[model samples]
Target: MPVRKLLSGLIGGMTPAGRFRHACRLLERADHSVRGFARLGQMAGSGMVAAQYQVACAYLDGIGVPRSPLEGMRWMHRAASAGHVEACFSLALMLLVDPPGQDGADSLLPTAWPEGIDAWPDPVAATHWAGQAARAGLPDAQALYGYLLATGPESVRDPEAAGIWCARAAQAGCPQGDLALAVNHLCAPDQPPGSNPGAVAALLRAAESGLPTAQYMLGLLHERGWGLSPDAAEAEKWYARAAAGGVRPAQARYGVMLLRNGRGNSRAIMAAETWLRRAALAGDREAAALLGDLHACGKAALPGDHEAVTWYRMAAEHDHAVACRMLALLYIQGRGVASDPDQARDWLQRAAVLGDVAAMTDLAATLLDRRDTPPATPAQAAAPLPDFRAMAQAGDPVAAFNLAVSLHRGVGCAADPAQAAMWMERAAEAGVVNAQYWYGRMLLAGEGISASPSQARHWLERAASHGLPEACIAAAQARLEGYGGPRDHAGALAFYHRAAEAGRGEAMFSLGAMYGGGHDVPPDRTQALHWFTRGAQAGNALAQFMLGRYLAQGLAGPVDRAQARHWLAQAVAGGVTAASAELDGMMLADDHAAP
Candidate 1:
C-alpha cells in the first residue's frame, strides 16, 4: 500500500484530537513519507491549530511533503491568526528574515499560495505577529521583538520599548536578550557608573551560556579595563575560551599575548605559533604580518628565510605595506628566492603606492637605474613613470634629489639645469648629504644658479661634517682655490687628507699635487710618489699622467720605462689630452731614432 493511503486508513477512524496527535507523531519522524504528510495536511481543518501548525512545519522543513514554503506559510498564518503563539512567532520570523528574490518573487515561499504571508517580506506584519506572541509571554518572541524594536527601520525603532522587552526576555533566561542588554549599556556613553555592574552581570550570564561573542566581549573588558580593573590573566583565559570557539579577533589577541610572554617557555611559544597560524589562515591581517616578522627574524624557533618569504608574501597579497617592502628586499637580495630585480621593483612599487616612505626612496633609485632600458611589459610601458616632481612636492627629500638628477641628465624629462639646481637646493635643505655636496658644487661653478662662494662653502662644510667623501674633496678645493672666502692652505691640506684616507681618488691626486709643489707642507718626493701611485691605481687620469711623467724623468724614484708607458696609455684611454700628447711625442722621438 502507498504510505499516504495506509496513513489515511489508519487515521480515518480516529477522533479529532487523536488525529492531530497522530499527525504530530508522523511529522516528528525523519523518515515519514511526503505523501503521508500531504494527506494529513488535507485532513487538518482551520480550527485544529496544532495539526495545522505541525503540517505547516512539515512542508516548511520538507520533512514529509514536496517542500512548499507557500503552503507552509498559508497554514502557519491560519494557525497564527487563530491565536497559536508558537505559530505566530514562526510566521513573524519567516516574514522578517526571508528577503524577496530578484524578479519580485518571495524567496521564502517560491510557490504561489492564495493566502500566504506576502509576495515580499513585510516587516510591519512581522512586528504585529511578534508583538502578539511576545505579549503572550513567549521568551524567544520577546527577545526578537526587542532586537527588532531597537534596530529596525526608522518608524519601528524604539530604544526605550526595546529595553522593556529585552528585560522581560532576560528575566525569562534568554541568553540573546542578556547579551543585547549588555551591549546596549556598554555603548551608552551617558550611562551612570552604577550601570556597568548590571552590564557585567548580563555579559556573565550570556558568556556562561557559551556565547563566543559574549566571551570575547568579556575578554576585551578585562584586557582594556573597561569598567573593570585590568587583569591580563583573566583576559587571557577568556580570550583562549573564545578563540577555541572560533572567534577570529580572540584568536589573534590570544596568539599575540602568548607570543609576548613566551620568552623562555617552549610550550607557550609553540601554542602561540599554532594560534597565530590559525588566525592568519582565517584572514587576520595583523596575525599574518606578525607571523611574517617572527619567521623573518627566526623568532620563537620559526624557520627563517623561506618561511619568512611565505608569510610575507601572504601578508603582502593582503595589501600590507610593510610586508610588501620586506618581501621586495628579500627578492632583491635573493633571500630564500632567486634574485629578481624586476620582481623586487614590482613589490617596491606596490609598497610605495601604499604610502611607505622607505619603499618610495628605494623605488626611485631602482627606476633611475633602469631609466634607459625598454620597459619589460605592456603594463610597465603603459604605467606612467614615477613623477619625481609630484613626489618632491609631497615632501620626499629623496624624490627631490632624484628629480634634480633626472632634470640635469635629461633622463625621461627635458634637460633643465636651472630647475635641477632649484630641486637640488631643496633636497640639500632637507638634509640629504649627497644633495648638499652637489648643490654646493653647482653654486661654486654657477652651472645654473648665480655663483655664491660663501654659500657654497657653507653647504660643502655641512655635507663634509656628515662624512661625505666627495664633500670633503669639494670643500678642500674651495679653500685651496680661494673661491670661497680667503684661501686657507692648512684647512685645505686637512680636508684633502681626510678625504684621501677615505679612498677618494680626486682627494689622493690633490694630496699628491700639494706634496709635489710644497703648497701646504714641506716638499717630499717620496710622499708625492706614494700618493700619485694610489690615485693612479684608483683610476684618476690626472694622477696617472703625473705619475707617468715623473717615472719617465726619474724625478720621484728610479725610472721604470715600461710602467711609465703603461700608465701613460691608461691616462690617454681615460681622455687625458696631455697624456695623449706626451705619448705622441715619445713615439715621434722613437721613430726619429730608428736606425
Candidate 2:
C-alpha cells in the first residue's frame, strides 16, 4: 500500500478532496523531496482548496520551495476565494502588518498581484478576510478582527462590533483579546476612562501572560491609582518587568520612580542609573535629559561634569529645551568644557526657540549686556536692544519687567514714565518680585505715577511679604511715620527686624535710632547700644556716630572715651561731619584733663 502506487493508480478516479488528502500524505512521506513538491503543486493547480492552502504556506515559509511572497499571496488568495479559513486569516495578517502603498513597508509583503485581485495590500480587504476566519471560530482571528475594528481607520472602525468579538475571543482564552478590550475600556472617550476594575483585571491577565505592553500599561494604572489605589511598589514591580522585557518607556518610568524613592539608597540609585542609561541609549529623550540632570547635580552615582555634558548634548541635539539650556549654562560657566560665549548663545537661542521661558529671559539679558555696537544717536541709545518688548507681549513676566526698566530709563526707547508705570504694574500683577518693589517705589516718589502713600504702602507690604529687603525697609518707614494710615509701632518694629535680618544696613540704623530715641516704647539703652554696634559694624555712618556718643555719655554700658574716639573717627571717615566736631571736642577735653 505505497502511497505513490495508490496515487498513480487511483488519481484519475478519485475526487478533488481525496486527491488533496493523498497529496498531503505523499508530501509527509516524501519529506521535502522534489517529487513531493511537484505533486503538491500539481494538486494545487487542479483547484483543490486544501492543496492550494498547503502550497501557499510552503511558498510563504520556503518549505521545500524558494520563499516567494507573490506566489504565496497568489495561492493564498485562490484558497481563500474557495472558502479556506486558515488561508484567509494568514493573508489578512500579512496585509495588516504590511499595508499597501506605505513607503518602505515590509519588503517580504506581496508587491505584485495576480490579475483580478487588488493591486496592493488593503486594510479593508484584511478586515473582510479576518472577519471570515473569525466567524469560522478561529480565536486568534476573532481577536485580530476586534483590534482592527476598534483601532483602524474611521471608515472601517466599529467599536460595538469590536467589543463583541473581543469578548468572544477573551472567553476562548486569548490574551490579545483581553489586551484589546482593556485598552478600549481605558481609552473610551465617552466614558470615565481608567476607573474600571474590569479593565484592570483584563490588563493583569494579559500582563501575567507575558505581554510587555500590557505590563507597562498596568504599571501606569497602578502608579496613577486608576481603577485602584496608587501603589508605588506594585507599579515599580510591573515597570521593572516590562523594562526587563525591553520596553523603552517602561525602562524610563522605572528609573524615574527609583530615583524619586532612592534618596540615600546607593543600591537603588545604581539600579536607576543602569535602567536610565539603557533607556537613554534607546533614544528616550526624557530619559536622556533626566540622566543629564542627575549627572549635572552629581546624583545617581554618576560622575559629574563631563558625563553631564555628554548626556545634555545628546538631549539638546534632539530638541530637549531644558537640556539645551543646561548645556548652555555649562558652556557659559566653563564647567566640564572651555567657556564659549558663542556656543552658549547658540544653545540658548535653540532653547528659547523651543519655548523655554527661562532661556528666553537669559538670552535677552545676555544680548542686552553684550551690546558692542555704540548707539548712533542719543534718541536711539538702546536701538539694538534685545527683543524684551516681544517677549513681554508674549506674557513673560520677567520680560515685562525688563521692558519696563528700558522704558523708564529710555535705554532702547524714548523715556515714557506713563508707559513704564503701566508695564511695571502689569509685571507686578504677574508676580514679578523686582517689578513689585520698583512699582511701589515709583508710586511713593510719584516719578512715573501719582504719589499715593496708601497705594505705595500696600504695594511695598505686598513685596515685603515676598522677602524683599528694600520693600521691608520701605514698609517699616511707612508704618512708623503713619504716611498712609494710623501709626503701628509694633508693625514697624517687625518689618524693620525682617529687613535687618536680611542684612539691610539702613534698616539696622533705623532700628538703633528707634530704640535709642524711645520713639514708641521705653528706651532700652542696652538694646540701643547693641543695635548701634551692629549697624556700625555693617558700615552705617549714622550708627557709628550714635555708638560713639553712647560711649562718651555712658548711656548704654560704659563711659569708654577710647572706644568713643575710635567710633567717632570711623564715623568721620563714613561722611558723618558731626562726628569730626565730636572727635575734636573729645580731644580738647582730653588735653585739658591731661593738665
**What does candidate 1 score on TM?**
0.51
lDDT by residue for model 1 (155-262), tens: 887788888988898999999788777766665557842257877888889888998888988898888887778998888989899999999889989998897777
Clashes of 2: 0
Q: Put down candidate 2 lDDT per residue, 109-197, tens digits, no spaces.
A: 55557654574557888888999999999988998898888887778888899889888888999998888888777656786657777
Q: TM per model? A: 0.51, 0.53
Lowest summed-lDDT stretch of 10 residues in model 1? 98-107
Output the lDDT of residue 471, model 1: 78
Clashing pairs in 2: none
Error of 2 at 276 (Å): 3.1
Off by over 4 Å in 1: 1-10, 15-17, 31-136, 148-157, 189-195, 300-595
Candidate 2 vs. truth: CA RMSD? 18.4
Candidate 1: Cα lDDT at 190:
78
